[model samples]
Target: MAITPNYYETLYITRPDIQEEDLAKIQQKLQDSISSNEGEIIKADKWAERNLAYEIQDHKKGTYYILVFKALPNASKEVEKHLQFYRTDILRFITLKTTEEAVNKNKASEEKKEKTEPTTPTPPPAAPPTTTAAPTPPPAAPEPPTAAPEPPPAAPEPPTAAPEPAATPPTEAPASTEEAKTENTDTQEEGGTN
Candidate 1:
């Protein structure tokens, strides 16, 4: 049986606090592991730090790295095992087989778009007339006849009390304290007689 090389993409996140030197070391180790397993790396890129959709291992953000390579099916397992050994450094990881045809298609489409797109620089706006002409004063309108100054406004009167609202008849009058007590005694007496 002939072994076929499969294209795979691995996306992994490292702890946010990892130093640049340590990060580079991790990347080197991953690349070495892939090469040792007879895998060829197509791209290894750091996608920069991003906020996680949800916290992982107390991490609110992590540095993302993607590795696209061609390897045997078993090589993916080996790579994943190697990454698992460095659990403390990595927050999460996922490896998936991808079709080379899809990648090629995307590249061709991007190239086509670039070729079809126009790159004309926008022309700067036309400048205003350089010659400064003296502005003419607007024609003066006829002046209105002057009137004697009116006396100052008189002091405002104090506000009157608000009108009382109309009283609506109550459905039932409240019983006085004495009446309530008598009613309570009558109920008690009736209960006793019963």
Candidate 2:
């Protein structure tokens, strides 16, 4: 009494040198025809303009058009009828049903797993509170005793160290203000893309 939508996809080949205007019309026509027959065109793909494995109708090159649509079983027959009119222009086409329902069923079954299996694992990380006792830390080592206080030592003067080497700035200073900021940023950061 009711028609269930099915995932259907088909691919066809067209003339390699078809004009850009003609190409859009050709693609839209397929979509329009599908919609007219109680079908919805999900997506269309222009795979590539490729040379045929073997010559078909004396044409060695063809443009591949792939269409993915959804509709009832009878609507697919009408799609085939549209493809039948042109044997030369369109070299070949094939329609196949996508098993989406089976795929969704598999997804649902995976979701149902946690319900059937135990919510909590057999051995939980920690059981309900059974008087959680705090762990005691290890004893600290004893400090060494003070040595005898000797005579007061003389204060040493601060020793002078050699002067640090002066840094030489980059040779590649960018000419523009914008470029200078960018180059300075590049120098500051280790990541120099150029």
Candidate 3:
């Protein structure tokens, strides 16, 4: 049987506090693991640090990194296991398979953008109209109304107090009272005997 290589992209976030040296070390370790499994690294890049949508391991923000590689089927399992074991360094990670169709589509769109971008400059503001028209006096401001208009009636004031708390059920209150009475009688009997 012929073995087929799979292309995968993994995005992971590292704790924001990790030092530069340690970050580099972690990257090297991942690269080594991939190579040892006969995988080829196509790209490894770090994106800008950003705030996470939710906290992970008490970290509010993390540095994002993406690794694109080609590997055998089982290589992904090993990579995930490694990241899981290093919980302190990695906050979160996800790996996804890249399909040939998607990659081709992306390349086509990028080429189209590049080809069209330079040819269009913001069409210079429509050349000023070639002919000028006689300037008309700005329409005279509407004559002020003869008398000041009456002010609108004041709006009703909102109620000052908050809505009353929901009423408790009658049955619940009686049950609690009965329990309290029983406890009080027991305490009274104990005091008298002593």
Candidate 4:
């Protein structure tokens, strides 16, 4: 039986508040630890600052880094322990065992892209030649007639309904004086009969 090392990819994030010098020191520490543990690093990159999907350890943003390496299982554990216990600048981290083929594939693609891209920066476009003659001022565009702005047409009024007939309260007719006298006399005659 032969012991074999495994490939791993570790993605870690550091607190955004740290200075660039401090960040460099952290990366150096990780590299040193990996080497000390007999781990061979294949790739290491700082991914720059990014906003976190959610805050971790009171940090809403963090600088990300990725490390890919081949190491014995125990060696990987040691690296993780170093980060988990010693690196307070780090906000979060995850390590995943990956295939060597995947790592090689990614490396190959990156190399191909670099080779295909242009290396030299194109020169800035030459400035237009300056003329010594006084440039004729472009004829002032005829000032459009300055007619006073017509006021916006008043909005059409909503159609009004026909005025409804006024409601009249029923009124009682007043009794004539002659009619009142006759009614009183009839009441008196009835009283006399009773």
How does residue 20 of candidate 3 score in lDDT? Answer: 86
Native-to-model Cα distance after best TM-score fit, residue 53 in candidate 3, in Å: 0.7
As a TM-score, model 2 comes out at: 0.47
Per-model TM-score on C-alpha atoms = 0.56, 0.47, 0.55, 0.57
lDDT of each: 0.69, 0.62, 0.68, 0.67
Runs in model 1 deviating more than 4 A are 106-194
Show where candidate 3 strays beyond 4 Å: 104-194
Write out the backbone clash pairs for model 2. none
The alpha-carbon lDDT assigned to residue 16 of candidate 3 equals 91
Of candidates 2 and 1, the better by lDDT: 1
| Candidate with the larger lDDT of 3 and 4 | 3
Worst 10 residues of 3 by lDDT: 148-157
Over the stretch 1-194, how does candidate 3's per-residue lDDT look in tens digits?
Answer: 97777888888999998888877877777787778778888778886699999999899999999887788767777778777877788999998999767655755886898888876665434434422332333344433331222111111112221222111223343344344444555666688798
Tens digit per residue, CA lDDT, model 4, 4-122: 78899998888877788877776777777777766889999886788999988888899898999987777678768767864678888899999989999999998988786655333
In terms of lDDT, model 3 sits at: 0.68
Worst 10 residues of 2 by lDDT: 148-157
Report the number of clashing residue pairs per model. 0, 0, 0, 0
Q: Which 10 successive residues of model 1 have the least lDDT summed?
A: 148-157
lDDT for model 1 comes to: 0.69
